[model samples]
Target: MDDRNIQYIIQEKFHTLSKSQQKVATFTLKNLQFVGVHSATNVGEKAGVSETTVIRFCYAIGLSGYAQLQREVTMFLFNEGNNSSLQNYLQSKQKLIENPRFYEKTMEKDASRILNISKNLHEEDFNRASLLLHTKKKIFIIGYGSSNLAAQWLYFTLNLLRPKVVLMKLETNEMIRSLQEIDEESVVIILSFHRYFKEPIQLASEIQDKKCEIIGITDSRIAPITKYSTITFVNEQQEMSTIDGMPALISFLNTLIVGMTAQDHDYYEKQRVKYDDFQNSFIADRWS
Candidate 1:
């Protein structure tokens, strides 16, 4: 068996571990070096659990006994320091201890991933999304928590290209007002990422009930919100130690806008001139 697979196994099974198992798992993941040198009773004391719980945690993570767990940690220390899960932003300490240059490596890794996303993007998905944005009667963009700002920026960009584009605001009445405007003819765009906020899921459900078209921008193809969407854009976002991937999402959004502009040059030019006129009158005067 590949002892190197233990870290990813722990991560993938984290949510399913019992409370006591989680306690042991958390401590073990953060202190693999210590586990390699210590006995089960000593490790248990450091993790604030009993030796039996340590043994149980071992079994829970698919190890036969505490000795195997120690062997795995030893193998991890000698090799396999660059496992992908260690690069995750959520598991901060692991990344630092395993690879001190994780930040720089992550930047290069994430940039390459984003560029590949653009290359692999399906033509049909792009055309369908751009066509809908150009023709929809009203477009409502929804995102909550970390995604709220991205949604707002998208709303602003789309509003400039066409009218009746609204960002779903936080207030209860505003949300109701936005939903009231949604129907079969309307289009909704939802931006959701890892640990996706619940509000967007519920909102997607409501929009699905209206039989409106949904455009889902998320990291996974099987993301919950995709069930309600007519078009789904899966732009994978890999989190670093402290930052979530935003550049990739922005790249996708920019492409969407560019596509729309290309589809209707006359309409876009008309809106651009109007926008310039408003900006010049209201904001440009400060330059003088």
Candidate 2:
């Protein structure tokens, strides 16, 4: 029990405490966000208290210490923000690595989401993306934060499948500047999820000028979607108990990659032959 997650603990038993303990609770309630990047001193300063008071505040809240408290607090906040069930499964797997129940529950939910998308998989969207994939419009996949890795993965993956696919994960303010290249019929795929991206949403809105279709691979069919989207694919990150886990999204994209690779045999064969040769020679030695 740590004060890092003081907000949750306080919420659980705020009214059952004494006056001094309540003071610390009030401070934490007011500025729980500050705890994310700040130390006890910084939080105390914002809470109108001294460093030692913050330490006592930690104990007062029933946390073992400040550090443990922070980890729990972070997890609580993260779980609260993310609603992806994929995260739920991955975390459960980590927690219950040796348990069969975790895998059983995880695969059930994972299969559900995956099968749902597969059942609802729109051929029209695939056609739209395929049409753009084979064409030339400087395809840009805009993702940031955790999705940056996804964007980069797509960038490389799509390169072997097609060509000239770029993953753009610029600063929030710099998104509009990147939209300069968006012209008539330009393909822009926006990838995002919890915590959502405001800049990409804005860019998608601003992309109305382009004749190109904007494909929104979003968590939902909501704002920050493309104007003339020929197809829309929403990758759902399944969360267990509000945790915005990423495995589902990753699995979805993995399917997308496999689908795209299967659709283009010439590209896949050439890339695979070259890759296997390189992998067996340069990389296989290390693995062996």
Candidate 3:
């Protein structure tokens, strides 16, 4: 509603709409370009609902009417450009499902998403985020649901590059206690995507109140976490689902890790060597 982000608006109001309207919403979200170009009657036919239901669906999602819906969809599609259109991405994904080269096609899709990060992510923000990771006194990484995997990976990798890197747990009491240790010098990296869990946003808000720097990695620029963040990296997922965003998120984290290490190559290289030595020594001590 705030940004004319039709997808976000539909998602927010999806559960409140009627079954027929929900169908139209789902169809419109998946086939944005088609909805933009076609009439309400044609869209309803494709969604397997009546034209009236389609118009109602538009209003249900807070649009003025069918015309406004079309305009919103058109603006969304135009802003996304031809390359990143949801319709084209969905069409390609459907084709891949029927193709014999399943593994290759899957990797190709992920590769495309990773490439998109370079285009979408701001260079200045990336550099500043890397610098924060390199110099911050303490670092905390948090992500809920599927995003936790990326958070854990970053915590593990970053822990080797620097000390005092904590992987924040999702438990309420634990998170509250962890807050006591966080200060302005601490940096919190949060990974949140579609179907975003509220815990991270809440935690980011708390961190913001403490004057700590928040680095937000999310699918949308308007994601709630962004409001509380000092730097944000938007990794828009091709699909509507949550898990599909992992590859790009991990790739972005990897690039961030590389950038952070590049800041003081000699120091981080020494840290990695020390970590490897400790691991080998621990293994020998346990085995012996």
Candidate 4:
């Protein structure tokens, strides 16, 4: 397998790539296994671009042509922490069907990979992010499409540790009202991943104009949200099932929540005690 970092190329040069080229790049990156064995025309059709655009995208990233791109992708599949090609990997997994522990093994591998990736995260970045969340006057969390779940998780967890946290509504008018409340003292945490949505990007741009700090929780450096973020936590996601797998992202959020709590245990304890008091009061029918 070759050592080419195709992801870095697409991310670093994304701004320069034309709209069609960008589309092709996104499709290629997501379906590298297909690209390794398919023709430029097939890829172009799948990406809704022409074969010429696909070839241009390959050259735009410094590859000689489609053939070289395939070769590189094939190499990437083989070298992706496993010494097997894409085809071989699929074959091996298929052969495991009759095995008693196949499903368990699959689950274990996925979980292991998700956790292992977190190890690459820098402590300094976490510290900076924790401090920002801890000190920011207000924190607004937003996500769209499939990412909304992640945004909600962060909002709920962070609110438990502090106050003035809100999960922004997805409706345009409602979100705009929340946006109007933002200022330099606000910190916006945006969750975005592949098949990137447009509203979040627009929201980030608006947040940028407000001069507030943006914390981007996304899947890659290439994610559009990162452009406006003051700090970014990139947790690579996988299509482990019919839907996207977000164990890694959830884990990262847990880390941030714990880090923020550790930053000031007294505040967290007070908040917890207050929550308990409210629960007790409700139980006693003390409120009208």
Report lDDT (CA) for all predictions. Answer: 0.78, 0.63, 0.82, 0.78
lDDT per residue as tens, model 2, 105-124: 66776677677667766777
lDDT of 1 by residue, 231-269 (tens): 988775434211445766776788898998888899899
Could you give me the TM-score of model 2 versus the true structure?
0.55
Q: Which TM-score value belongs to model 4?
A: 0.69
Instruction: Write down the lDDT that model 1 would get.
Output: 0.78
The local distance difference test score of model 4 is: 0.78
Candidate No. with top TM-score: 3
Better of 2 and 3 by TM-score: 3
Candidate 2: count the clashes. Answer: 21
Clashes of each: 1, 21, 0, 0
Ranking by TM-score: 3, 4, 1, 2
Arrange candidates by lDDT, highest first: which order? 3, 4, 1, 2
Best by lDDT: 3
* Model 3: per-residue Cα lDDT over 1-288, one tens digit each: 464367767765766899899889878877888998899999999999999999888888888899999888887667556443345446557767898988797998789989988886788999999899999999999888878889889998887778899999977788877898899899999988765788888888778888888998987655677788899887775465455567888898999999899899999879989989999999999999
Q: What is the C-alpha RMSD of each candidate to the true structure, in Å?
A: 10.2, 13.2, 10.5, 8.2
| Range of the 10 consecutive residues with the lowest summed lDDT in candidate 1 | 236-245
* TM-scores, all models, native as reference: 0.64, 0.55, 0.70, 0.69
